[model samples]
Target: MLPPLKALPVFEAVARLNSFSRAATELNVSQSAISHQIRVLEDYLGESLFQRQGRYLALTQEGKNYLDVVSSSLSHIARASNQIRGEEDTKIRIAVYSSFAVCWLMPRLSDLQHKHPNLDITITMTHGSPELSDKTADCFITTDTEKRGFEYQLLYKETLFPVCSHAFYEQIKNTLNVTSDELSKRLKDEPELLENFPLITSNGIYNEYTEDWRSWFLERGIPLSNNIKFHKFSHLILAYEAAKYSLGIALVNDYMFSDKDTHSALVRLPSHRIYTNDHFFFSYKTSRRNETAIKALKQWILNEASSLNTLA
Candidate 1:
């Protein structure tokens, strides 16, 4: 038999927060009620779950062990309850950066809707890397590598390559009598050949300032030349435009190119493609990973990511 199942939430809340008053506030009950519920659990278990130390509460050894089981069991119960209530009726709120929304996600959303007609998703666009918390949104597509309570599934690592306008692409072809594939091979034979043209890159888009260019050159053991003409833009989109309009070659990410085949003016140089530690991930709460709504969304995102990566 269950030992006062009604008190589980109150116990979990108080144990997690380590404060009876905070748990009472969270559970929307009086502090006395919180005490009564905890006392009921202690009476049932015949063991102290928490010990007080100067103005704060700490979980005992038994409480620590019990918390792990309690948390998992409660999560399972919550997920099951949501499933019974038709979780699909609620929209899954996903937060992403604006650039991703514009360059990658927007194009593929139609396909997603067609494929999973029942899966409802609402997008929230953020300017910078989103500050994720319980209140932020249901899921996040971000470059944040930090592991929190959330489960992060890497969508793709950012692939850095150079691109230029058709006119510039032709000029390079005429001048060198070779395509980018050939040029990439030639660069390995003579690294100095890299200095022949202007280079464009963006600022503040990576972990370090202009790590895109640095990483590309560093990966190939090519020394960064100080004499190379550099055109710096405040953002990657501006740099992409610079490269699109015959503004020499720009170091760009795969997402910026989205579907490279579609861009007539833009030509990808596909140089030893530098895959960076910087990645875009599909993240959600781990506790809800098993819920049907979350499972469907996770599978859809994984499928889409696989398709996009394969196409790229």
Candidate 2:
């Protein structure tokens, strides 16, 4: 009762390209083969779909109408076929903050891959909170702001502090001709010590609660003057990288600075830890909580977090 499905693709290719020869070249068939299929399709519909002007081709009104339906149908078929073959099942999509992905999750991904060799994991990074309603990702690692329809598991809370490269710290100590303890004491007691250095801060957009430089300084009772030299970065990850290379001091959360390689390169300033109320959480749709891939990824993340806690 239906037109031949095989001829539709050939006809679509010819109609879209406006050249039977070009369509044959694209589809890896002969020009005569393309013409034959188009004729077969035209016979089935009882209509002339193309107007031939010597070597050129143009779609008739009916051709245009049929193309709209045929293209949409083919796309739907391809999607459904891929879905039926389990192409979508093997992937675990995770949404997370850009800074957390760069500084924390990326480093630990190798361990995850080693454990689950066949699993395909995809990462989507965001600066602010991602939309839960879009169904873009299977799970999210985000700050503990509640989403109404999602279930959350608390990962850990973070402590904020100033971090800088060892080279920069040594430069300050040598320049002041003081011991490490004295250098730390001076940093805490003398606001001028902080004022003398180039301070790095995140751009005041995205998540304002966690990334505000002015709030961090004000919380420690230190005044932030407009005249002080400051370097601003779009994301905390960029600021962290800059701090690692001795460019400037960056205010970072504990989790971002926890990697052994990162810790070796940087030192947290003394007497300046601020424990935040914002905890990190792993969240997913309550309805999809039982999905096998989602469950596996969730348990892996929890295990990784547990190891970090043990090491801490």
User: All models: lDDT?
Assistant: 0.76, 0.76
Model 1 accuracy (lDDT, Cα): 0.76
For residues 86-122, what per-residue lDDT tens digits would candidate 1 score against the true structure? Answer: 7643467788888687777888898888877877788
Q: Which stretches of candidate 2 lie over 4 Å from their true place?
A: 1-89, 188-192, 204-211, 259-263, 275-277, 307-312
Estimate TM-scores for all models. 0.65, 0.65
Model 2, 123-241: lDDT tens digits are 99987877653234778997746677688887877666788898998877787888998987887877456667778877623354234556666776776666667787777778788
Q: Which candidate comes out best when scored by lDDT? A: 1
Question: Model 1 segments beyond 4 Å from truth?
Answer: 1-87, 145-147, 177-185, 207-210, 258-265, 307-312
